[model samples]
Target: MDMPRPYRSVLYIPASKERALDKARSLDVDAIIFDLEDAVTPDAKVEARDTLKAALKEGGYGARAKIIRLNGLDSAWGREDAEAMKDAEADAFLLPKVSSAADVEALAAIIGKDKDIWAMIETPMGVMKAEEIAAHPQMKGFVAGTNDLAKELNCRFRADRLPMITSLSMMLLAAKAHGIVAIDGVYNQFKDDEGLAAECAQGRDMGFEGKTLIHPAQVAVCNEAFSPSAEEIDLAERQIAAFEETEASGQGVAVVDGKIVENLHVETARKILALAEAVSAR
Candidate 1:
């Protein structure tokens, strides 16, 4: 099983703000979402696209993935946003409020299949139809638009997020089923490490590829949460060694920490080591 790139900390930077874009170049984040949707007011949306295009052309973001969040196709800005960014230097374009496969298809039509898309599963309808969306050929990722989903569901923002679990799981299942990246929504309490850490743990345990972020302060915590710990890395290394030895002896199994290590376990162990190396290289 091949693991995709780690999106452990994807920080959203407003494309309209020059300072924010410049500052993001230095942030210790795996990916940067150059947002032109919710972060920009109508007056700034058009100009922000130009600013982002220029910034990407200037090229100081290093190895961090660059994703541009476009406004909805139904909105006034979305089409033009796509048109403006089609030639921009970005790994992918994130579509906000994607309801079904058609929504992704529409964006794909405009942007062309050359670039990929990350759908924002924020609405009730979107959650229900997540499977079709994830199945889209150009759809590469899913972002749990938790804040918007909560608002749409008329649910309280509880720490446990009991009300939103079903929807989140649905999106996760769809993404994983389609071999796409599954990213958890933002933690608004950027200044609260304890709260952020807890939420990051929840997302990681839920098998999210990473957590979408709103602030630079949240990166370290988010990165740590998704990363394989030292102990985990050590165990993964030992598991690989043991499994290799077994293979050399023509056996199909090994044991690590007294647990059965089979082909499945070796695959998982390899992913852990790969993720650790990716984090270090980032």
Candidate 2:
């Protein structure tokens, strides 16, 4: 079945926070990730699960996708979370610390074909088997967990992200190869708007469809980063027009704004136009 691909801003909110859940219904984010894993304490897991179930029943996400990030499979509450969310009216079930294809298969067995599964590639083991994990037939997409990955690898965050760039890039490559959306990890420092913007730009350049956001403030930045700017849309239009002229068709390639534009460039332009339309509709 063809699934809706809302790979823009996936906003994570604690399942226990009724206020945040209520606010999320009105946000412009592509998805609302109701978190029942790391965000909820063990003592509150049951309560969070119940609250999320209730919210799901309320049905106010509008056009935005609805998702739930469950605890790792190894956790005590993982199975319970899956059971609770299997029919929670969510778009997908996010499995954290997805280390192997089996992890996804198990979740898929529970989720069945009704709900898609979004796997998190954060741990070293998960990174090592990202391709396999993403290859699962029921897998919908991937969300990079940069914070957990950095901690596991003991690497400091740098502008270049050299330490983990290979893993991050490989995750994106796997998702693309499997025809699934891939999202960059959340930027932890919400106060550093400049830094966050830079990372968002870098992620987009790295082939990420969008970004996982921690705060509502990060939504605007994520949306802007993944969106095609006015200048870019204009250039895409010119390139597409030039290509349709037939004069440039047999040329194999043509120069748009002094830059070589090819069939691949046209594909990218179409995606940009699609995103522009999606944004405009939203």
Candidate 3:
């Protein structure tokens, strides 16, 4: 399966801040979410939309994939946000609080079929209906909204993330079932480098394609977690070589370094190689 570019470190920038938008060009993030929602104040929504429009047209995001996170579908900013970014070179509309397939279809109608929809499954309803939400044809991915999820669930935040783990895992399963990407929520402790790395590792182990990042300081940690390690690439190459050598005989599985390699393992190896290529290009 071909993975879409891994947005392991998706940086959120308030669209109203012109300087921050300009500075993002030098950052090493995989994607940028120019916010028209939570990051911008109600009074600044219009200005932020304008800034995002101009920025995308001017190529402010550099090589990072650009996503415009619109306000909720019920809000006034949502429709206008889609309009302003309609012609802008945004990769997708990061639809906030999408609780069902209808919500995705609604955005798909506005954004058109070619442009994709990245849904934020933040609410209790969203978590309960994750599989249905991810079943949309144009749904490209799901980004976990743990902060909002905690708020909705009325749970206190903790390092263990026990309250949010089930919801997060549900998203990963749903995304995988539908062949869509699943990304973890941001680590709020931006200054705690070690803590952030641990959270990234946890997300990676849970099968998340990447993590939503809040600050530039978190970029390297997120990238490192999602990127293929040297050992992983080496193992992948060895598996491929082993499988190729037995192609004429057509064995059910190949063995490399005493480790059995199956077709499923080969798929994982291919994905790692693809990630390596994307990271190198970035």
Tens-digit per-residue lDDT, 1-282, candidate 1:
444588999999999999999999999999999999999999999999989999999999998999999999999989999988998999999999999999999999998988899999999999999999999999999999999999999999988888999999999999999999999999999899999999999999999989999989899999999999999999999999998999899966788888988888888889999899888877
True lDDT of residue 56, candidate 3: 77
- Tell me the RMSD of model 3 versus the true structure: 1.8
TM-score of 1: 0.97
lDDT of 3 by residue, 174-229 (tens): 99999988889999999999999899999888888788988898999889988889
Q: What is the TM-score of each candidate against the true structure?
A: 0.97, 0.94, 0.94
Of models 1 and 2, which has the larger TM-score?
Answer: 1
lDDT of 2 by residue, 1-282 (tens): 123355679889999989989999988898888999888888999899889888889988888888899997788999888887788888888999999999998887776865789999999999889889888878888999999999999999887788989889889889998999898998889888899899999999999989999999988888888888999899888878876664535655577778876778887787777778777777
Better of 1 and 3 by TM-score: 1
* Model 2 C-alpha RMSD to native: 2.2
* Model 2: lowest-lDDT 10 consecutive positions: 1-10
Clashing pairs in 1: none
Candidate order by decreasing lDDT: 1, 2, 3
- lDDT of the candidates, in the order given: 0.93, 0.86, 0.86
Superposed by TM-score, candidate 1 places the C-alpha of residue 83 at a distance from the truth, in angstroms, of 1.0
